[model samples]
Target chain A: MKDLDGLDLPTFEDVIAAHARIAPHIRRTPVLVSEALNALTGAELFFKCENFQEAGAFKVRGACNAVFGLDDEQAKLGVATHSSGNHALSLSYAAGRRGIPCTVVMPRTAPQAKKDAVIGYGGRIVECEPSTSSREATFARVQEETGAEFVHPYNDPRVIAGQGTCSRELAEQVEGLDAVIAPIGGGGMISGCCLTLSTIAPHIKIYAAEPEQADDAYRSFKAGHIIADDAPDTIADGLKVPLKDRTWHFVSNHVTDILTCSEQEIIDAMKLTFKRLRVVMEPSCAPPLAAILKNPEVFRGKRVGVIITGGNVDLDRLPWIKG
Target chain B: MKDLDGLDLPTFEDVIAAHARIAPHIRRTPVLVSEALNALTGAELFFKCENFQEAGAFKVRGACNAVFGLDDEQAKLGVATHSSGNHALSLSYAAGRRGIPCTVVMPRTAPQAKKDAVIGYGGRIVECEPSTSSREATFARVQEETGAEFVHPYNDPRVIAGQGTCSRELAEQVEGLDAVIAPIGGGGMISGCCLTLSTIAPHIKIYAAEPEQADDAYRSFKAGHIIADDAPDTIADGLKVPLKDRTWHFVSNHVTDILTCSEQEIIDAMKLTFKRLRVVMEPSCAPPLAAILKNPEVFRGKRVGVIITGGNVDLDRLPWIKG
Candidate 1:
């Protein structure tokens, strides 16, 4: 843990500055409550809807903060990221807003719709083999070739600080929240919640929900150290990545517990969310709600804030329907 | 025109009263704007999201007003209605809220999901043949037996007043809107918009959108009279019903025009709304957006308010997907 001392971990003040930096580009996304979901969970739940974000995810908040915070010289070189999902689209959107170039290093095998969306947002694509080493190698090459700032999807301090803005808004929107939960992958969003709520609303307990198939964060929490998983698969594809040092610092210290749910539970929770909340969100956003529904005793009678992280999904292949 | 002298029409004052009366029951549904949509349509569109209403449709506003407006004696008998769609579900919801019995006379062939939802809201369903005459006869018999006060879905003054509150909210939520558009489905929502906008902001033009497959309202507006259609088939099933006298009174007088789009256009607009707005609205909500897209010259450089009327749809049968 002492190794973190030299790393520039973001503080609450950084979160405040990040909020100010990205306020113009990001939405103060609405908080929605459902009587039916409340009755079913035995908890009063407040859903912070980042799905309605212009870039269709909470990732845009971090992307905008990173893009807009760049000084004139750095901004001229532009920003780059390796992602096949919302992060790619969000970063492209943010860079486009600042009139800077965005280069995405994505797998050559990625869906055409996703590639088209990134290009639609004015991002240049650099194709890579669909593997961890290949993606990292391609990303490094792209950064070296272009001298562009590499924006890690969730690991960067700036990204965590920007993500903290969501919980800050959630706390302001809903008073007396006894707990807050979010789906955790690389822990950018959870780290942000930890950073913000620990400073401003320490009484509120923070929890991270993960897909059972990709429960490295849960294992890490139990073993009192970081646990890395290689290519663990789950329908909640956004959560397949491993947590890094900067995110691990917040997850270890502030998060009260890490919870996991089965894939079927996630799908059920997703369908229920669509039916009850009447919002279209992706699979990654379902784990928190699934955890709550699966272990109602943990959330019962508490005022809980659930982060619906993103809404980017293929409408044709909704998970609940048979292929 | 003189025939309307004896008919009771809801006024702006009634809209105010209805707002106050149903304020506790209904949400001040948020207005959403999409920059992507704006870029495509060339209009600054403000979407009034009644789809986010607790009962999943704007019909809840009207239903709540009717159910809550009943006096103690009338409440004792409860409420009755004949509908095969949102009104049946909405009235059931409102009646359940009021702790009153709700009897719905629905077609025997209506989807089981629809029937289950109505029953879930504590409504009693009396099924009849899936025809206008059989539905009316069944409704008449049920009303006679139960002594429940009948609530006409769109043609009643109370319902019109309740629906007007949606536009009242929109008018307050947005500034300097040049025009407001909503799909014409028996004209309940559009009539309500006309009622509220005519009194509060008459300068704002009111446009009704209709599917070409069931363009009776458009024909009626052009013909300068009410034109009733019998059992027209369209993907926008909600708009197949013809406008009644009460709604026609508003459409013939206050509505600026009724625009029509083909069935394919409606389906395309529905997909675009889901993709751009990240919302789960039904096909009935698509016509207004379709009309706007098809006639871009009409809405370009204008601030347009689009009423997304409902979100209740079968996920398995999305219009854009091949069956």
Candidate 2:
């Protein structure tokens, strides 16, 4: 909880501080439980529904932390990020809360609903090619032009500390959770979970759920090094990013294991969650449930926490309703 | 809050009894609030989400009350009901919990999903031709053969009192609501709201929302008499039946107004609820929201309670997705 290299990397103390700083700007989303889902999966599941969060995702936690933690002069200059999904909307929402300009670079192929949400939250979108190089190039140009503070989606200490607040709330909301599972995208949420659970409830296991199609996190953990993917295609669009050093520190140390699920499994689990929990969430959020369903032995007969990461999908183009 | 007409007709006292009797069987569903929704409509709204209730609707409260309220001799023969929706599912669920026999008579034209749910909950289903005369004849024969106690979907005092528990919880959860809106079908929920709110908080306006395509409740409220509709088609399939004597007693005496919304407005409101609330409520539950959106002048800047009725929907057959 002490100085972790002058806060360049967040410690448990930093996450606790993030909770205090971002508490006013973000929502204290409720934890939901479903008997039908518990019966179906054979696990006592507690869902931390970040889909009900301000920007419709857990990304808001970190974004709010980063935006609000900035010095007044730095915050006035604004914030910039590159995200094709919930992070863009969340950063925009956080920036809007502080009454500052937000610049977001998103892939042109990103869903129109996500783009609309970012714009609705008062973000200026800088469209980039779907490739990572184009996105970074555009992001760099925007940051330079706006002179905005650069806040990486998952690599920054403030954002990781911010996401840590979710698990802190979950640990307090549900007693005796045997394990906690969160879908790993750029490893922000899982790292945050590791950051908090390691410091507080060290006995609890942390699992990172990933899409099989975009399984860089799984591969990286197995290989014992960072394995970057350029453009991994999956129904879970939010999880295509590779892990960086800040996120890797926690994933490599605190996480018990990284689990993976197939594209069909993700879609089916998502449909089931929608049916039983009656909560509308995107495909990216479904991997944790899919992992539990696929490996019931891992989660059976235990109190487990499942984080529903986001709920910003175009209803007109649900994966199951094939055109 | 005393007894009226012996123990046969439910008084406000019956609602209090129902709340205690059914407490062991039903869920004390959560009250949700969405800032985005409030910002859009300018109404400080509190949603009593019965969509998350056991058997996926508030009918479970009534069904549980009816099943549990029966005496030793009456419960021996078990219960019977004729419903094409949530009531049938609810009765079966309650019966399943008590380990008793339950018989449900349904029109052959009812959705396969509803029939499956009834059977899944251990109820015997007898399908009849999709006509009022045929349904009545079939239901009579089933009850005669099975010797089951008839629990009418919305007409019976037991069911009305059971539904009253919802507003009771809402009153305890959120304070000083200017109005409460519920979608009306056979006037059961609205009547329950009337029964509870009139006694507990007489200053709060009670509004009944009805689909314009099946506006019998709206017409009957204006005419100051019960106007029975045998069959009326609407997307809110649950709100098609006519008001009966027990429900009419409360609806006529206590309800402030009956509001109607067009089919298109209902669908649009449903989509909005799915997007903003992140809960998968059926079309029948969308009328309160639709009415609020259409009549913001009446609800603007006021604290309003919106009851979300049910979540038993077929995802494959979403209205926005054309075949």
Worst 10 residues of 1 chain A by lDDT: A1-10
- lDDT of each residue in A1-323, candidate 1, tens digit only: 12356877888998999999998898999999989899999999999999998689999988998999999999999999999988999999999999999999999999998899999999999999998899999999999999999999998988999999999999999999999999999999999999999999999999999999999999999999999998799999999989899999999999999999999999999988888888889999999999999889999999999999999888888888876
Error of 1 at B176 (Å): 0.7
lDDT tens digits by residue: candidate 2, B1-323: 33456535677898999999999888888888888899989999999999999999999999999999889888989999988899999999999998899999999888888898899899999999988799999999998998999999988888889999999999999999999999998888888899889989999999989999999988998999989876789999999889887788888888888889999999999989988989999999999999999998989999999999999988997877775
lDDT of 2 by residue, A1-323 (tens): 33454536789899989999999988888888888889988999999999988888899999999999899999889999988778899999999999999999989998787788899989999999988789888988998888999988999988899999999999999999999999997999999999999999999999999999999999999999999987899989889889998899899999999999999999999999889999999999999999999999999999999999988877877888875
TM-score of every model? 0.98, 0.97
Question: Which interface RMSD values do the candidates have, in the order shown?
Answer: 1.4, 1.0
| Chain A accuracy of model 1 expressed as TM-score | 0.98
- Candidate 1: chain B TM-score equals 0.98
TM-score of 2: 0.97
Candidate 2 chain A: worst-modelled 10 consecutive residues by lDDT: A1-10
The clash tally of candidate 1 reads 0
